[model samples]
Target: MPLPDLLVSAIALVRDRRVLMVTARGRDVHYMPGGKIDPGETAAQAAAREAFEEIALDLDPDDLVELFEVVTQAHGEPDGRLVRMRVFRAETDASPSASAEVGALHWVTTADLDRCPPAGAEVLRRLAASGTID
Candidate 1:
């Protein structure tokens, strides 16, 4: 049987027509800053916590606006495994740097979608279609 879908939360921090993306240590594909939701934590809270943990960004859960959700094949996992991502868009003035599991930080436009996982690429495409990013 296929494994259960991975549940995750992600944040979109866009500025100047670009959105923030991150690559985990030793990984080449990039995605939004986020991870699995801990037990008893809301998706928004998980997203905020992941942002801080992965990229050293301080995000308030209350400030996150639900942008959209994506269901796609889970990157780095078995072929049948899927990921359900709850994505949010929020404004942050603080600078983000690579930290924790994050290997690097990048500000990417739609042109860089191919560098992301399926779910991440879908998020970028939607953001671009909505004019949220270039």
Candidate 2:
């Protein structure tokens, strides 16, 4: 039997034709600033909590707009494992800095997709195709 999918919630913060991405401590691949949805937490709530924890940016759960979802082979996982990521778009006026598990922050364009994990690359592709980011 196949392993169950890993579920995650992610937030997209686009600015000036670029979207925010982060590298977790000890990881080279970039991903959106979010993480696994905790028990008893809505996806939106998890996204917001992760934004604050990972990037030091507080986000209101009410302001998160469901952007897209991606299911792809899990990066750094055993073969046949998959990840299901729920992506959300949210606007914030405050600057984001690396925090918690984050090691570095980057504002990336679609051209940088190769530096991301499979699911994160897909998010960049869709965002660029929609003209939400360059």
Candidate 3:
């Protein structure tokens, strides 16, 4: 049988020296502020929706700058599953707070990557390499 398809859209809302991260309820690994792409929704649309749903921050789809697209083993999911991630950078001055499925929210830097999931760590590493974050 084919592997279960898992497609997600995430956002890195960077400001100052930190990027926004969220921990799902009952989960320890923090991830970028976004979630799965719903049927009929564009990846950018999903990214914006997930950001607002999880962090209570409304982000315009047009304001999101596409950053990276990576396919990797799914984290916290069944074996043999894969995740296709479309990561974006949203420009906003709004503060993020825990909401919806988010249990805790944090603004993290490169030093805090140990607490992040693998995909999230990859995102941060790329951002740092691109000089987008310190």
Candidate 4:
């Protein structure tokens, strides 16, 4: 059986060769620092909002460059839910600290991508293959 699709926005904050990943409190799996778009919110707006909520990284919505969008099984959701993630890339030097539901923030290089969730794994793969992030 297939899950109903979910729409969400995700942001990739890349600096040097590392991208930022966050883990929710009490959770072990890592994910990109973004979340579901609110009603009437655009993808970029949601990405910016989620970034600030999760990591305290204040980003301009206009600064986000769309990297890609993918549909994948929602990692922690019920069995019948899928996520359509719109990923964006931005350059930021501000340090990211855990906030809101985020427990910790980790800088993930190409070698550390395996620590991420499925959607994050796909984002990393696409970024790596495109040479957007090493």
TM-scores for all candidates: the values are: 0.95, 0.96, 0.92, 0.89
Cα deviation at 3, candidate 1, in Å, is 1.3
Candidate 1: give the clashing pairs.
none
- For residues 9-124, could you state the per-residue lDDT of candidate 3 as single tens digits? 99988888778888889988888988899999999999999988889889999889899886777887777788888999888877778996899988788898899777888888
TM-score computed on alpha carbons, candidate 2: 0.96
lDDT of 4 by residue, 57-112 (tens): 89999999998898888887887588899998866878888996898888776676
Winner on lDDT (2 vs 4): 2
Better of 1 and 2 by TM-score: 2
Q: What would the per-residue lDDT of candidate 2 be over residues 56-129, giving only the tens digit for each residue?
A: 98999999999989999999888989999999998989999999688999999988988999999999999999
Clashes of each: 0, 0, 0, 0
Over the full model, what C-alpha lDDT does candidate 3 score relative to the true structure? 0.86
* Candidate 1: regions farther than 4 A off: none
Estimate the Cα RMSD of every predicted model relative to the unseen true structure: 1.0, 0.9, 1.4, 1.8
Give the per-residue lDDT digits (tens) of candidate 1, residues 1-134.
88999999999999998999999899889899999999999999999999999989888999999999999999889998999999999798899989968889999998998899999999999999999888
**Total backbone collisions, model 3:** 0
Clashing pairs in 4: none
Report the error of model 3 at residue 116, Å. 1.7
Each model's C-alpha lDDT?
0.93, 0.93, 0.86, 0.85
